[model samples]
Target: MITKITKFITPALLTLCFAISLNSCKDKPKKESTIVEEKVVYPSDIIPFMDEFKILCGDGKSYNDLVDVKHDNFFYVENDGTTDWVVYKSPNSGVTSRTSSNTRTELGQKKEWLPDTGGKLTGTLKVMHVSTSGDARVAASYAVVVGQIHGTEGHENEPLKIFYKKFPGHTKGSVYWNYEINTEGDNSKRWDYSTAVWGYDMSVIGDTPTSYPEEPKDGITLGEEFSYEINVYKGIMYLTFKSEGHETKTFTKSLIKTDFGKSKELPEQIKTLYASIGRDGSERENAYAGELQNFKQGAYNQTNGKDPEENMVWHTGSETYDGDINKQYKKGCYTEVWFKEATVGAGTPPEE
Candidate 1:
């Protein structure tokens, strides 16, 4: 979603980037359903720890405050002055809410927000509605999974920054905008998305996908068909804002549990899989390894090691031995999670 959607932006707001596991049967349905082990510090505990970093957008003085996560909150607040903040949560992604009051509006991208592509703004705009004098009649919009969000309303609200290399020959209110966050922190999750098709110019550089059904003749453009990758289980939650909720897509990955208790040593291995990060270059791995502590996309695994971000100090806790991405990869995904962790006290940089 991040890659496919963000192409609607100025090329500075987008990011794209990965899988798997297997296991056995045996009605071992206990582990996946439970947040059974380890102490999950409530939002109250998570807020102060998260305060060390400057906010890129929105205002949340504390964790319990309006931290509408993933931009998934479906609060039906009219675009009036009272629609100050969005605070909501999703089971698969975790908790996050942010303030959208007139006081918290940010006009442009943060200086720190940079795309890996030659210092360009990320994503694109699929639609735009601006006044002839230069002001946004409507704020920028975005979606996270099933959720939709509008930019902090204010200013000349110019349709100025709106752009997309995709969706050419479009005039007036025919374009859309997209914003995407990445797994700057977690490793356990991934999103199915693309950065091709639908855009005006289908000349997307780098490894263009050949397997897509609507394979554009030139390179891939950004629109309904462009795709990319995203590991959303932590790190950054990319916001793909389309024009007036135009880019609302969904990814329903119904995960099944596998049996990892079959082996003696696998228990320890599974523990690492759960408590640490996943995928070698996975964002979660980087955050768990404490390498991504400075980035905005939060990390998910906060156990069994030096605190990543959140000041989530490690503490011994009961482990949940469900078939993690590891077992899912082995059996279903046909991939392997080569787990790694820091030595007792040796500092290390993550290597893919």
Candidate 2:
């Protein structure tokens, strides 16, 4: 009778221990739910072109490795809630290119080509800001250069300089392109011929710094989306400008030769625009033909902190504070631009 009772007590004790172990397992805390947030993609992540080009930032820093990388102030990525844009910003008084009195946060293509072989470059962008301080009588006042095709060899002149300019107290700005003259004899006599595609030319400015012009009813505003294609093929460069709610304008120019070889052949617009600056020279017979050229796209600020009296046309009397980036940008002496998409490649032949 005692042995049977012991057997029963042992079985009951084992079952009790098993039940206690199960309750302990159930009381343990579960792992906290992992929450993963999405990462913000940058401009280089969207358009990786580190292998094809080099970047010159507004801070005077050159970047050869740009893939998935960005600079804090000069070059960075901005997301406007719906779209991510590549921003190129430059202060008016910072370090600049050797040939011009401008600063840029722009891309320089690694490859070069001649007019005969040709090349194509396209960009969809908008001008966010330009220097707000400048003399109205100056041509570069309140203006920013957004794109260019610069010659790498020879005179190292620029074949194209696209600009977006707005006057103070105006609601809309102008979209124009300039063709720099390849001087036949003296480079000092060189000038740029501006052609308006959407609004007024560079010459349309106020009589004084305080005076104002009528707002362009059919012009582009700040942060408006616009695009340009510089396609050079078969010795001719074809340009296409497009923006929503505006006319799609197309233009063609001969890169192999100039149509304004003589003063008499110069377009009347050039005389009116360059008269104040004393630019009366004509382009060469063969314009930019056979010259090694490359594409440049980004914010090439036309404004500067120099004295307005030195060179009224290109020298802007904006606030530079001796190359202080913080002071320049805060004082509205800076240019900022954003690009959505871009491509660079060989020019495609048009179908006959």
> TM-score winner among the candidates?
2
lDDT of 1 by residue, 180-251 (tens): 212333313311112221232111211211111222233222223222222122222232232232344332
Residue 117's C-alpha lDDT in candidate 2? 94
Report lDDT (CA) for all predictions.
0.21, 0.85
The C-alpha stretches of model 1 lying farther than 4 A from their native spots are 1-194, 200-229, 232-290, 293-352
Model 2, 45-116: lDDT tens digits are 766665688888888899786777788898888888898889999988777768767888988998999999
The alpha-carbon lDDT assigned to residue 95 of candidate 2 equals 76
Name the best candidate (by lDDT). 2
Compared with the true structure, the alpha-carbon lDDT of candidate 2 equals 0.85
Clashes of each: 78, 0
